[model samples]
Target: MIEHPMIETDRLILRKVTLDDAKDMFDYLSDSEVVKHMGIAPYQTVEAVHEEVEWYHSILKEQTGIRWGITLKNSDKVIGSCGFLNRNGKHFRTEVGFELNKEYWGKGVAREALEAVVTFGFKHMKLERIEALIEPGNISSQNLVEKIGFVKEGLLRHYEYTCGKFDDLFIYSFLKGDKTNRKSEH
Candidate 1:
């Protein structure tokens, strides 16, 4: 089994999500604005969040993915979650995904958390490439991925079925030896 380590950033702590986090996860996840671009409807109850958290745990156990609950340094409450999904060990590539509380939006929290996660993916997990798929309408998310050095690859038409209709998604990628990663080395 792959061990999930606690990754710390200057303002955030990325750790395994627990049952205790259900309430907090529900807090943000249930917000319409938060789930707008996510393609899913807002969570109706904390119980749903509980089940989702359990599913996240199962994915880790199956060694298919790893999801971390993002909490602030001064608080234990999870403000968001981020992780690698659809990891292909043989190809050394994985897709990164994250969502933050709308309350924390524009505060740079997601960027900080994502940087730590990407660093871990490259240095520890040995990932050669990290990719992100974002809906065309999610300008904020598109900015976030590009700010971190992911280059826009292309659009996948009718890529995902969300909210009852098929939606196009833009793919962005960052490679191991890219300028962003290389600059961090020194």
Candidate 2:
């Protein structure tokens, strides 16, 4: 809760997002394609990114959630991020969200980061359920979560309003001790 705990995979390290990460974060966040489904419009400046970084830190400080800057193991530049947000302690559940620089897409970077975060959620955080809400048209995100073993729960009609309109989201979830999740943990 002090800050996001670092998590390492074979090729990446997930660590706390700092103000220094603004530029790198901005690199992807400013790309309309990268943030197209994220609700908010693409950021146009580092100042906006700095606000984002602060929000990441603030979530941790408030005990609501955590976000980790995803970086390659050999380099410090942030390429993406994956973590839990909207944590519900009483229900022992949380929602997971992730995004990567477009260049890193299709190379399994998001999967690797997500698997690690999912493991942390069930193990370190003692969560009973981890959910992912994907915009219906985002096939890649849907595929990623499915491949990671999350079961498709259903669709929530006009579940959220972001950007300028209402959007439908497909809800997917992985429960603690689920065989699929357990297999990925190892």
**TM-score per candidate, chains pooled:** 0.95, 0.96
lDDT of each: 0.90, 0.90
* Superposed Cα deviation of residue 150, candidate 1 (Å): 0.3
Kindly list the per-residue Cα lDDT of model 1 for residues 1-186, writing each as its tens digit.
567799988888899988999999999999999988888899999988998798778878886678999999999999999998888999999999999998999999999888888888999889999999999999999998888789999999999998899999999999998877332465
Model 1 scores what on Cα lDDT?
Answer: 0.90
What RMSD, rounded to one decimal, does every model reach? 1.5, 1.3
lDDT of 2 by residue, 1-186 (tens): 484689988899999988988999999999999998888899999999999898888888887788989999999999988988999999999999999999999998999999999998887898999999999989999999998899999999999999889999999999986777434546
Count clashing pairs, candidate 1: 0
Error of 1 at 121 (Å): 0.3
| Model 1 per-residue lDDT at 71 | 97
For model 2, the local distance difference test gives: 0.90
In candidate 1, residue 186 scores what lDDT? Answer: 55
lDDT for 37 in candidate 2 is 84
